[model samples]
Target: MLDWLRVVRMADMEAVRWALVGMSLDTVERAPVGVRAAQLWVSRMLQVGLIDRARPAFRQGSVVWPKDTTSGRVPDLFRQTARHDLAVSAVSARYLARGYEWRRDRRPITRRDHQADGVAILGGQAELVEVELTPKTPIRYKAIHSNHGERLTREGYTRVVYLATPGACRLAMKEADRWLFRDVRPRVVAAPVMDARGAWSGEPDAPWAENLMPPAPPDDAGTPALWEGIA
Candidate 1:
């Protein structure tokens, strides 16, 4: 919890709920007690001063880093892109539950360009994660893809994951095929961001999890045909 707060810097209760649900499954029904438990812990943290809280820009309350650190307020991270960052944090939490390493995009100030939301290491494969809440024009997408491809090649990332609505995901996959090189193109897979109503809730809609691990074989199965009759 401390690590997640440090990485995300500023996130509210709804985003916390999203993370809890994501860790259990893609549904809101699972792991609800966790959110309440987390809320209690957060309230206690407030008293202890291990973290600080600020009035939200979009959501209700969020904890931030101390004044000395960069990006010290909830409103600061959400001043312009509340929904986007919330989604990214929720996704990052889910990735954390899956034991993936997380790094928020803190591109240097000298380089001002479009940057991905975060990077995640899944099953030893580094992934560049982009959370798209809304679709953009093809010209804009072209530039974004170009940037992503350059980063993928330069930074040793294996795949570019586009998390968006189903339609947007399809567009991402199409653009990936159309734009990125054939060698790395196959690695791109679009996973729709599940339950993104208010807080940008995140859940792995099968394809993303399948990329990391295959399902186990059936239990207590019969012997193979070659050995079945021999016994």
Candidate 2:
């Protein structure tokens, strides 16, 4: 009955957990384990009845999930957009690269809040990561910023990080400016541009400067160290 459990490798288990939060085949393929290996693991999981796939409303590819997990009254991974799928994958890759472990809880911080796209833990720090692919209305963004800013601090998170495309980053920054008093302004980093192998195509040691607040000082001598330590 549990034969699928036996064939499951660490990577397979990780993939299933990620599916609980919704992931695309492309995202699963980008795991630290090489693409071919990840593909094999996902296929095996499907065969064993540990996971299922569904075509999201507007996406070209299907999203995956565990057989039947629920968050509140809703299915855990339902109707995600293509942009959301890519964002989740991109954020996951960055955290995985930084040696952070994915958290398993799928619940929201409070009944009034929504689940973050994903959470990563390293040492004593927990980071709530969000991928903003599209801009939310100004009112909606403010509500989100206010809710998360308060809850995250109260929950003892080290910081929140938002990995976003260039356009979305600008919108987030504008909202952040309004909520600066809440101190929930997340460290914003440009989502890494990756190739098919999941390897980043840009300069490895380049500082993450997109949407950086209080912009870096003009002179090299005075510029605050700008890298977010993500390598």
Candidate 3:
């Protein structure tokens, strides 16, 4: 079951934003139940560190490029990127709490091609992260990601993370990383959070598999004696 679910994956960014977009659409359509459900799902994912708010640009860096350095559509691209970044940020924060040090929103090596979402460099760890908004088929997608895993490997980033929506090309990207860098993370996460409706409408039949609830507490007499001496 774990293997099966692993195959049915979602990037944290796309999962969170997809919920947001669905809720937004429901709200715009005046679907009250859908709106409430969407809100709940979004809230749940956020609370669990599956999604986070994007950081503001320019902690204090100078405006290195002209205002219009990128095409007009660039802002839109940034918006898309930011959504994914938020989810990745949430994941990074969780890892940080667990003693992993990471830097978010890293500046690009070049000002001309700076990315709004930015990459994360795990402290003293050979890992590089890049979040993707568009499907992998786009030319920009290729330009940004092509040989990235190999380059990162050469540069000592042992693993590269490519978070994106589910698609054939996206899957291929993961495979490509295997052939090129030999250090990419094995799994491309699919983080599809259930909407409120989706959550309520379904049965909790697979509780242990999902780890949705804590294991039942021990009896008042204390835990079973089966392992008492072992402890």
Candidate 4:
């Protein structure tokens, strides 16, 4: 839990629960104790000062941080990016449950000027994962994709992935389909969170492919691929 918190840094109580749920993902029984246990353990940790939460915890989008492990300026980004970052954590939680080796540095800046959300490695393929809760300008997309494209050419990455929410998902896919470069095209899929303090709605339904993009995996678990020749 500390490792996930340190990597993700500042997540709300519910997002933390989702991460715990991912760790509790069982191939045999699929125990949901992660949800139940999250509250208990977190409260206990607060009492013992192993962790901390936004005061009066019932406030809208109350978040928590690893006070024991945190340093520098305290969680200032919590207010601005809580919704987006928690949504990203939801996506990461799903990946964790699916057995992907997903990770990012505590600072989360993959490149000097370009920071993707996280990267997933599985089956010897490295996927640069981006969570798009809102759309960016087209020109911004052009520049970002250009940089991401360069990564495909030189970096060890196999492909890029845009895990967008409902509205943003379609735009991400449209942009990918319109991309001229097939080698660097990204796989855009739906990854919606169920409102504030809610769970990820698109859990366990993976690699949602359209028109010959490989069938969706069974409900148990599945891996999302990086962009191939899927243009």
Candidate 5:
């Protein structure tokens, strides 16, 4: 069932005939060769119990179902599914492991009326996190920083981080060094791109059960620095 489901999902097979037709072929995108190849592959696997033989039902006769048995010589349907699933899991784990308090868009946080794209709780208050692919001009970045800074100060959130892609991050650093070192600057934290391949490349670490938010900023420029939230 799992194997059938996997193939069904990957190839969009609705019925046994479709599954059989999909697995054979000279090329998946073309016909005849594609259909025949699928039929042969499915039939051969069924004969070997690499797939299950379903009980005959009314109208439909007995059908071959792919079974995900852990054998060295087997179709990789289940293994492929598991690999795809694990990649997604690894990315999610990286986010949670980094002390982010994820909330859906428009979800309200107590004490602040502002809803966000996503937020991380800093100092017990939700600070909106904006993940960007492009770098904003210094004026634009400063404006964003100030808005978040003032809001966090007023609402008692310690700071907010703006996790940007590598290119944008470099621009942010440039602006930080040039303009933000003197005056009111929001604590913007940027991290590296978490690609699908890199998601599972890190050490597995458990997330913190609880996190503490720091006290509000005293002045406009007195915001605390940003840190990599991962422990």
Candidate 6:
């Protein structure tokens, strides 16, 4: 099943498994047809004891694998809200469309010491995509901006795009203005939060309303390619 889905690594498989938890078949069907076939693959996984499903109060049921199946730590399906899941789905869909490989980098950036949601790599460059459903306190935002502004170049990211709710995007843009005085290099662009259905309603040419500067030129070296090694 993993090979059929082109899930090359255990980590990527785990990511797909976690993202599918509490997500409906309709939502999964939004993925490109080849990937959307997860509907049937998931059923087979359940039969083979590769995954499990649990019903939670006040929410849809969730699919999860046994602790021993991958990471020993328990999955946090209970703590995840619908908005959070939608954000993940939205980003996943975007990366999937672009044919960028996904990595679940739960670790903090070495230079900034801030944990990004995940990293997507196409070829040479890596993009850090941050999904913000709710705005953080001013102090927290300041810290994030300060760290990212200082370390983006040193950390080797091509750019950092913040996908957040309209209100949160406004706050992020306001904070980005402060970077002008500091002379941050890596571009920061803010796009609207994806809908619950994981679709973007914004214009295709310019999805971002707030950008510290013009969007960076495409990384020609970072052209889309087949998925490769897993971290």
The C-alpha local distance difference test score for the whole of candidate 2 amounts to 0.48
TM-score of every prediction relative to native: 0.69, 0.57, 0.37, 0.70, 0.38, 0.63
Model 4 stretches astray by more than 4 angstroms: 24-34, 55-62, 68-73, 105-113, 186-199, 203-231
The best-first sequence of candidates by lDDT reads 1, 4, 6, 2, 5, 3
Local distance difference test, per candidate? Answer: 0.59, 0.48, 0.34, 0.57, 0.41, 0.51
lDDT of 1 by residue, 1-231 (tens): 666666765566655654544445443342333666767766777777666666655555663433333544334654566556666776676666555667876584344356677888655667778777677787777877877777666766776666676556667766776887765665555655543433443344443454432211222122222111211
The residue-by-residue lDDT of candidate 6 on 102-190, one tens digit each, is 56555664654787666667666676777777778777777787766655656776666777666677677677666523335226666
The weakest ten consecutive residues by lDDT in model 4 span 211-220
What ranges in model 1 sit over 4 Å off? Answer: 17-33, 52-78, 106-113, 122-124, 194-208, 212-231
For candidate 2, the per-residue lDDT at 49 reads: 65
- What residue pairs are clashing in model 2? none
RMSD of each: 9.8, 9.0, 16.7, 6.2, 17.6, 9.3
Ranking by TM-score: 4, 1, 6, 2, 5, 3
How do the residues 1-231 of candidate 4 rate in per-residue lDDT, one tens digit apiece? 777776776666556655666666466122234555777878887888767777433334456777754453466543657567666776665565455666882342455346788876666666677877677776666666666666666766655666665556555655655652654453333333334433355434334423212223222122334333234
Candidate 3 global lDDT: 0.34
lDDT of 2 by residue, 98-179 (tens): 4455553367656667666666776766666666666678887777777666656576665555555445556666676687
Model 1 weakest 10-residue run by lDDT: 222-231
lDDT of 6 at 108: 66
**What shift in Å separates residue 107 of candidate 2 from its native position after superposition?**
4.3
Index of the highest-lDDT prediction: 1
